[model samples]
Target chain A: MNDIYLDNNATTKCDPLVVEAMLPFFTEQFGNPSSLHSFGNKVGLALKNARKSVQKLIGAEHDSEIIFTSCGSESDSTAIMSALKAQPNRTEIITTVVEHPAVLNLCEYLETEGYTIHKLKVDGKGNLDMDEYKSLLSDNVAIVSVMWANNETGTIFPVEEMAELADEAGVVFHTDAVQAVGKLPIDLENSAIHMLSISGHKLHAPKGVGVLYLKRGVRFRPLLRGGHQERGRRAGTENVASIVGLGVAAELALQNMEHENTVVKAMRDRLQEGILAAVPNAFVTGNPDNRLPNTANIAFEYIEGEAILLLMNKMGIAASSGSACTSGSLEPSHVMKAMGIPYTAAHGTVRFSLSRYNTMEEVERVIEAVPPIVAKLRKLSPYWGESGPVENPEQAFAPVYA
Target chain B: MWDYSETVKEHFYNPKNAGAIEEANAVGDVGSISCGDALRLTLKVEPETEIILDAGFQTFGCGSAIASSSALTEMVKGKTLDEALKISNQDIADFLDGLPPEKMHCSVMGREALQAAVANYRGEEWVDDHEEGALVCKCFAIDEVMIRDTIRENNLSSVQDVTNYTKAGGGCSSCHEGIENILMEEMQARGETFMPGAIQKKKAKPAAQPLVTLETPEPAAAPAAGGMSAFQRYKKIEEVIEKVRPNLQADRGDCELLDIDGKNIYVSLVGACSGCQMAAMTVGGIQQKMIEALGEFVKIIPVDKAQYAAQLAQKQATASA
Candidate 1:
């Protein structure tokens, strides 16, 4: 039984190269970067090189612009809070409704703290409403935070153009690029995005390391204030080993960028097309042309996502669902709801996020395993058969059950 | 991932009695697609004996929910209508070994469907009295009566417990305060006080028990004497601090215990908590929690940094003398 992991959007397996690069930092290079001794200076230089590697991956102008934090959520918090604190008189924020909980939850907390939050709505294809977004931007708005690409549906938002709009209004624009940093080409040095957040684990790096890129001359305030670490922008001792791993992962991501665009995209499309062709009443959720190269969210009607995922798990194929039951909420994914997906289809949406490690053979295995599972679950569904009273179980049951 | 029991996995993977019964005397359907779980239960009854001749169910839900409906059907087969009505949600869960607390609502759905089916069999209107109660959790459309009954039936004690039993405050959490209010009212009506932070304290106690017992004489013996030892008091104070630390940390603040003299606890507020306007609330809430967990005489004093430094100096001076 082969184990096929397709839930890369949640987290990916760490690359061996990244782990090999980090091994020495845990034992041989154990000195704190803050110390004045030679041992510390050696570790400090390695940290500098790691920053440069990440800077090159994202096309940042200076290595000093990258502030390392604990994870993506911390970077997001720092960027949004710093923007708001820098402009105290501006008590309004503009964001979209389909943002990950890291941004949406903070926006909700800020709303209670007397900041007016304007949640831009999305269309049926999960595209942001640019007109509504533009109308909400003004002198009173302090910051505009949005994701570069959604984690669930893989819909890419126009952060580059939106940042330009924000800059014209003198507002700080930030993007949670956790999903887009490694998969897509980013040229932040030429873009107007004032701040961006990236997580290490989303790529092949280990967890517990993240980067917050602040363009030079951007007003900033630290979320954690104590030691003068990360140039007083973030306060915590460096997660030395994880940071080194992230740097190596960034370099690897840059090297494989083209392969990701072509091969991984092809495998993702194969899985999506095969599932759609085999199953009836199945369709992709996001915009096909503008989505991330490694994602495909397909909805199978008249069934639930959790059941589909469990049956797929039986086949050793791991995936994620946008169903409300799976999320521990009674409503489906906010991304699906924002797109106005009907209840029947939204309850049955499954997300298949590929990675550079995925192969065509693994994709083919998943494609072959999904149709029978969907058919079996739908056979048990009361809503599945042609629009009338269900047939008698006595007639439908096989001899073994009868 | 959910820690589903083996029984639940078995029932979900190879569910029994999954199809609809033809010429069924009674059919009951509950839940909607939007609610994330729904069930349709059908029963073939032996009219002369008033016993359920057979049962079948079709469920659209997660593994635990589907398993729960399947378990309900097996439990009710061959039982009289009255006997089947006595099959509570807990019985269904117990039949499946047990369910994660969050998935207990799936068992509740199964029980509700059973009641609806029984009502249909008796030719009686299944009155949804839930609509009469004020809507408490707007996200799940759960009303106050449903929360109250589940609380009473299960002896639930906290907002999280209520959520696990009824799924009332699980989404958005805008209605958590309302759920808390209902829980307090229910507890009070039953002549019990629902301490605000008791549930979390209870959850933490088991993990800390071995260490506490190893150091102290015995925590079990403290309640008998109304006066706790210094070590026991220290352990309790640490527990209280751990309980409030996350709330403080979320606001980028922290707290530390400076000293404890008898019933009074001196604490220092650090980070963002030092000059916060809600410093009083933070201190008062900690004091309330200590009093609730320890005893009524417990008090907390928020000592400033200068005062703490002076007290330390005075202690050193006394030691030298």
Candidate 2:
């Protein structure tokens, strides 16, 4: 009955356990982690345990590989820049078209700074073209930064395969796992990924803290030069509380991985399935089976996403779209556009990212509430009148049913 | 967001008089569904006296379009042609308590529909024969009389000039030409067109001097009865710009005095400033600093990229001097 949050992709509520882990560092254990005092040692120990938890979550071989930064963006920036700095002799970087702006924008800046950039494309369902991705990797390419999951579509990428290809090409591989971590299982030991970025806020931890998992024996350079914190890799006073929260959340996520994969995926499937059954023209976006279990992106033809979002807000449901951001901009979603989704359907797309806390009752509520709203909006849409509301319940049910 | 007024939203959701008449004597159609907004107005006219018997509309657009059409229907339901002809865009906006300035064109559209309907009822041939007489904003097909009445009622003096005028450039951007034509015509009618466009360009450009002394008369006091609220400051700026227009024309220089903040009035130095070295001095020192000092609510911003070019010209002139 309370506001149903479907925008888990944007951010998540901090879990109570994570909050409890963070409480002491804010006051009782508020010592400069670097200072030579018992107080500092006590907090320093907490930081170590947090790092260990993060390391264990990703199955990293060493705790030293877990480097903490302010957020996912900073982690991504550090990874890309540090790789290029370590290999200054190389001037080329390869990445995919569907990367987050944190990587894409930085890549744009790098291109302007004389770095040759290669962007791989995605298919109509937002799956990256691995054949093209393989061809683009070469000796001159110093770094490869691809997202483990597309933020808008929740399409999981072949990071392991890509990492293997990059390794053969002598390139440093990095995946922005901001949307993938916790939602999917990640085992660095079994994967060729040399570096991966994860943010606290995407899971159930507070913002302003993130982790960059850099494999041992990897050469890198630090972005900022000041303190000895983060093993001389990053030089800033630690966000002790948020870091603690992120560690606790990561540990909890590791513990819940199995249950979440099944339970959360079921809820996602139920909601996506129900909407397609009720609404006339609803279709899920991205690779239907390969996507994150908690994400469901659907396009209800003929209605604008902002209008749907507004109406959903009235009904206490929160969802997002790629369209509203595109209207005033020439740059549509690099992910959607690369997939060649027609502009009409691209603008009407809505993304629903669920969290583990979401329940079947909430899924049922959404199934009950969403169709009529879509029907109402369709009445006001010019597109709907032209197509005539996709009549015949059999025709409406055929895609999902068949 | 379009900065929509509450009135616009209300009428959009619960339009007062929607739908069409079964046997309508006259109909007015404005805009298209694909153009972002449209209104189809229908009215039954009493043939003997040419008074509207009933009025209704169906609009496909934003809240402002729906509201404007709804207000138009209400305004002309039982009025004669002359009375309805006098219904300006502002009257519809006022009827709905007010629309955002950019959306004033929606009201203009509504008025256009009513006028077109009445014109159609009175014989479209008659209205067409008096093309110049009707005084239309050729771009949006808005009439001259409505613009004059809007200015008088709104105490407007400038063409940045638009607020709540319908049928003007709201979408698709093609109607902008007509709006500009209407604006020039309005200025000409007010005897404000001393030397427009190339006429001023034909005058020889004066070489820039170090001490470019400007003679600006203190702006005339605005009509106090209209209230000196910050909202009305734009009208006062309009008056000041008009007074300064003649001097700018005679000097063969193009300058725009923009009201950035109600308190700051900025005069951008153009022409020679286009290539002047003192462009920053003109923008920061002369324009911005001066404008901010003018009114408590005013802040001036100079868009002149040619400030340095003007300074270089002035420096050359000073060396010659």
Candidate 3:
């Protein structure tokens, strides 16, 4: 069986069209965009066109506002550090508890460096408490870095409204829109969002490429200082091939966003419905409708996420769990913890993020393979004391087990 | 990502005896939820023969722990009581084609669950000297008799010696006092009584004598350092060393009492400790502090590189000529 991948939020396989667009940069159009030769000008014009494409996707007024970085984490670090540099006197930062570690860890490092940070709490539904957010906002606040949508929970935040509030408070607003862009419509022209971060690998583009949207009048210091690359904003040799790939991906996503909302969501909902019906003690872990249409996180009580992943690996079904990182710390996710999920349930969190390429047939196949695996782990789990078996372990596999 | 043997994965995926027997003649539960793993086992016996009729298990743990418990259930299903009671953790792992070294504790859990289940069947309870034995460290499934035997055999003379040998007093300091009490009792029983104030005399003198000999001389002079005034520092050092000796014996190594001025310990690493990279980590991480805490008056030292290199060179020159 070909493995079914449902971790698009973690990283995505590059689309074939994006790969095709990147080929010329590797073979025929290889040149330093900043060089004086004609070959350099040709590639430089290609880079310019790619920048224009990315600018159109986010609805940026000028192409010069976009700065390409290595990845979303780099973008986050650059934005936060630059904001602090721009307003050194303002030593306060306000962010939500559910921000990705890329933003959260940087915020923590900043706090240790004398920046006062206020982490707004999240409700059980994983939505940030806006009242506390408003209460914490002041002129001393340097920046409010909120994610457009949670990578783990997929709970969409009100970034526009928050940006407007930050504008009124004279605080810079940045959103890590790595999960939102390409899947959702982003109209930066109408919003007060001064800085936004988006990654390529998140939207079926190549890895090692990301875009940071800085408004034309925004003043920020450079995180990577060396050469005058990215017009002296970001310093690094251009990842020409991957940038081309990201440009194509952004164009495809702009064309496919509406269809993803409708078609992809239907498949995601069907998969969620089937999983809920087939397995006991399994429930979705985010806001049902407010979540990204392509994403669903579920917690299976009494069983750990690693054990479930082990079982899923046997059946050639690929998914991600929030239990253990490569570091082997068995701590539950901070995102889940911020939502007040108990460690037992929190460690069992598994994320299933679909893509435009995912199908209803694959969803059905997942539903067919999941019940027995969950049942087996539940039997050995001590949390659910002797609850017998789930309602039907053999429903999906009557012939084999019987 | 581990290169698990196919058989190990098979047993883990489809463990033979997994579930609970509705009406069981025996039941046992080991570990608690806070420790992150537990096992509940149930067994049924044939009325006439007392042979295990069926065995089933429920484990709240990682895959290996559950699989080990399930393996134990299968190992004892058809055995008589005495035969089943003799099964060790190694037996479970050997049956499952050898487990990873770190996961040996899983097999230990398997052995504990089976024993606990059988004891539950026979309605046996923990006792001071009931022969069936008492739980050693509830966190790691160690027992009292095992600790005593390890201490006596290894010649471990301190609380740290017992920890290195039996992994007791390794977690949650709540249990270290129990280990200390057990060590004291065992030492007293062996005619090595506690002493106070011998530490001041030892500090005053500058000769190298065996620490165990110094500790065993008198009980009154040793325990002068604290509210428990009879526990002498040198005596505690001897007690810890005596316990650790037999443990080193299992691996063909030996522990020696050290004498140093700036520090309380300075011992030669004769065999296995001479070359191992983790020798210092093992010593500094566990042994050094354990010995220091129990025996405050003596400094401990493993042989440094300069001394070890000279010894190696002398041996090499002797061999070459």
Task: Report the C-alpha lDDT of model 2 over B1-321, residue by residue, as the tens digit.
Answer: 444567766765566767677678887665432223445677898888878888878553445666788788888878887888888776787788776544555686787777667766767731322222242333334455666566556644444344233323423344444445566666677766523353222323234333533853234432222235444656665665555445444424455763343334556656534333224433443332233323332444555446744765897799799
- lDDT for each of the candidates? 0.85, 0.72, 0.76
lDDT of 1 by residue, A1-402 (tens): 669999999999999999999999989899999999988988998899899999999999999999998899999999999988888999998999999999999999889689999999998989988999989999999999999999998999999999999999899999999999889999999999999999999999999999999999999988999999999998889999999999999999999999999999999999999999988889999788799999999988868899899999989999999998788667788889889997778989999999998899999999999999988777667666654324652233211100
Please, what are the lDDT tens digits per residue for candidate 2 over residues A20-51? 88998988899989999998999999999999
Q: Which one wins by lDDT: 1 or 2?
A: 1
Q: Each prediction's DockQ?
A: 0.20, 0.04, 0.11
List, residue by residue over A194-259, the lDDT tens digit for candidate 3: 999999999989999999999888879999999999999998889999998998999999999998
Per-candidate RMSD, Å: 13.2, 14.8, 13.2
- Candidate achieving the largest TM-score: 1
Model 2 in CAPRI terms: which quality? incorrect
Error of 3 at B22 (Å): 4.9
Native-contact fraction for each model? 0.44, 0.00, 0.22
Candidate achieving higher DockQ, 1 or 2: 1
Q: Tell me the lDDT of candidate 1.
A: 0.85
Worst 10 residues of 1 chain B by lDDT: B202-211
Please list all clashing residue pairs in model 1, or write none if there are none: none
